[model samples]
Target: MNMEFTPDQLQRYHRQMILRELGAAGQQKISDAKVFIAGAGGLGSPAGYYLAAAGIGTLAIADNDLVELSNLQRQIAHNTERIGMLKSDSAQSTFKALNPEVNIISITQRIIAENVAELIRDFDIVVDCTDNFAVRYLLNDACVLMNKPLVSGAVAGFKGHLTTIIPGQGHCFRCIFEEMPPDAEEPSCRQAGVLGAFAGVIGAMQAMEVLKLVTGAGEPLKNTLLIYDGLKSEFRRVNAPRNKDCPVCGDDPYITIPGC
Candidate 1:
């Protein structure tokens, strides 16, 4: 790839370029990559912000939610002034403000059985910032089917887990857990109650994973899961092996549908 950066881009990303791992070439990789972030809430907030500031070429945010007063506690993308606006709309505005040079695509729709594949087909990476297991599973299955990499993270209260899913290369989300929670609920940062700073920390980690995946700077979080306990300021990594009997990606697949 004949990748070159203009004077303006160099000036804008000088700090990022100074990092030995993220030279002009890596920056160009980021500049040419498209990322699909599946939420505009807490995790998605900082993930999208940093990616935009780092100059990801295009960020497609899919969120069929609206900004509410309660989201202000953890979802840094939306503010009091943005109340009543769609979450995607609020996030797109924030992203543009951070770096107008970054292209933003806002899909104010839910990721459902009918359209998840189309949303991620063109993106270089997909970030699972959504709060529920259903959306997480959907994204996992879609990415696995399409052979795309997915950066997955979730925060409930002061604890969170982050993992990278590379289908056929490593364990998928389904490989870890067989089925969704029996009593599934619409993921609400409101009801679950998350520590604000913990959300920022996890979200920022998610952004770093995205950069690493795009720039090829380090070993991406594949075949393992990182867990954080904000209450004690402790962190740990655990092995995540792909199960041969995994319903979605295993030898004998249970769920099969086109364009999941």
Candidate 2:
């Protein structure tokens, strides 16, 4: 990929380019990066929006769900007019309009273990905006095996959390939470009801994490978990250490075992 920026790109991204930490070199890095976003609902919507506007070279969005009336509350990227459209397709349309310079690819199928690795194989980084633990676990394991960076975020009710998982560099999700909790034990937004802007806040943070990872502008959430309580408007950062015996990222990683 050419690292040179065009006149149009320079003008479009002049503001960010002026930042001492993210000058032309950093902007070029962002322009040459490919990002894989896994789901296009509340978190994906805002995260993808910022990345699109920031001129991320290629953004591949994968989501199987179609937009619903309920999604409009926090899915700022989709509208009532796109209610029935596949979320990925809808997100593509919105992103393309926001920044025509970027390449936006949309995948409209459910992400399964069989296809997840191949889907994100070429991307530099993976962002987890998935709503369920099933897909999240699938991505966490796949990214660890593939040695890719994973930026994950989730929100429920008025609380949310995010963390950056750099395979071998920091903690993998499995090291933090050994197993997926039962769905009934952790209610979803539908039952718990998240505030709209709360999702936006966390999603935007995920976007910032992606940009930082791509440009090396700032320290990402590596080895740390950030929790946000919207009701109290507070943010907390806790140390996240990788467990040497973590099943997915341990010395004897389970990913190497076939069908274990």
Candidate 3:
């Protein structure tokens, strides 16, 4: 590998390069890695910014929504001035402003099962930042089928969940939830409400996990699920196991198509 950094990139990533766990080699890996973020909203906002700032080689962002004034509370990537723009486009602009060296591919369309695998095949890591269960499940299956590592997260009210899915190594989202809950009214960031800072905290954590994966700096959440209680400032983690009977990545595989 040609491990050369421009003076500007070195200055921008000086802090990361100085860290013992993430020195020049790890920094180089970060600068040569590719990641795909599946949403452009709250969770995706901070995650996208930090990943780009960290010099991830390429980022493929997909979102079919437009920025809304109401999204400002938690969607930090978009500002009032960009309200009429597509969410992915706005986020891409912010990412470019943060680090022009980061290659960004903005897909202003919703990802369906047919396109999910193709969209994910080229990326080394996948980040699940979507807000809905359908999209989440679809992403999980696609990543598993493609055999890529997935950094997943979800937040509602004052709590958030974080986990990484490594095919044949760790359990996937379906391993825990199995199936979507019946429409029994779950509080979402849009409905019940979420603290702006809470999103920042979780999103940053997700970004950290991605960088860790890219740089091989630390063990990822591979076989564990981390839950954050923002209101109480507590973090809890549970060990997860790959289910032998998991529908998508398991022995009897029922989710041949992406769950989306």
Candidate 4:
């Protein structure tokens, strides 16, 4: 890896570069990292923003939905002027503007089993920023099958949580939650409004985890789930063990595709 930084690049990331853990070498790794984010909503907005600012070389954001007025409450990457615009397009514009050094790929399509592999195959990291459990499970199984690192985050009302999965190093999402919860059991942001800026807190944490993963700095939440409670202003970490019987990451794997 060349890992050379131009004068402009050096100045752009001077703050992070000065850190002993992530000097120019770490910045170079970040500059070479490719990240695939599955949604451009609340969590994705802030998570993608920090990644862009950190100058991740290639950032591909996938979203089939259009920006809505309701999304403005937490999806900070999109503004009032961009209402009705495709979420991926909106995120592309925002991230590109924030850091022209980043090459942003905006995919305006829903991720399906047929295409999810190719969608995230080339990326170094896969971020689960989608809202619903279906998309969550789809990304989890796909990443496990593909052996890609996954940084998953979720928020409902005033609570949010995140976990990192490095294949064979720790518990996979399926290991912790074997099956998607019943639809009626899932509390969505739409039904239970997320606290404003709370997504920022959680999303920023997600971004930090990504940075750690790329730069090889601090811990990356492997085998542990971190939960945040906005109302109580509390953060907790719980061990998540890999289930030997996990269908996706187990000895006899089962899930070969999405929705299977």
Tens-digit lDDT track of model 1 for 53-80: 9999999998998999988988998899
Residue lDDT tens for model 4, 1-260: 56788999989999999999999889989988999998999999999999999999999999999999989988999999999999999999999999999999999878887788878889999999988788888899888878889999988888888999998887899998898877734538878788659988988888999999999998889999988999999999999988889999987887788422
Over all chains combined, what TM-score does candidate 1 have?
Answer: 0.97
- The estimated TM-scores of all candidates read 0.97, 0.95, 0.95, 0.96
Q: What clash pairs does model 4 have?
A: none
* Order of candidate numbers by TM-score, starting with the best: 1, 4, 3, 2
Per-residue C-alpha lDDT of model 2 across residues 1-260, encoded as one tens digit per residue: 45677798889999999999999889989988999999898999999999999999999999988999989999988999998999999999999999998999999878887788788889999999988888888899989888899999999998899999998798989888888886633437777888779999999999999999999988989889899999899999989899898989988766542221
lDDT of 3 by residue, 1-260 (tens): 56888898788999989999998899989978999999998899999999998989999889999999888998999999999999999999999998998999999868887788778888999999988787888888888887889999989889899999988787998998888767623425666688778988889999999998888888899879999999899999998888888898788998876433
Best by TM-score: 1
The candidate, 1 or 2, that scores higher on TM-score is 1
Please, what is the whole-model Cα lDDT of each candidate in the order they appear? 0.90, 0.90, 0.88, 0.90
Off by over 4 Å in 4: 184-187, 258-260
Worst 10 residues of 2 by lDDT: 251-260
TM-score of 4: 0.96
Q: CA shift at 186, candidate 4, in angstroms?
A: 7.1
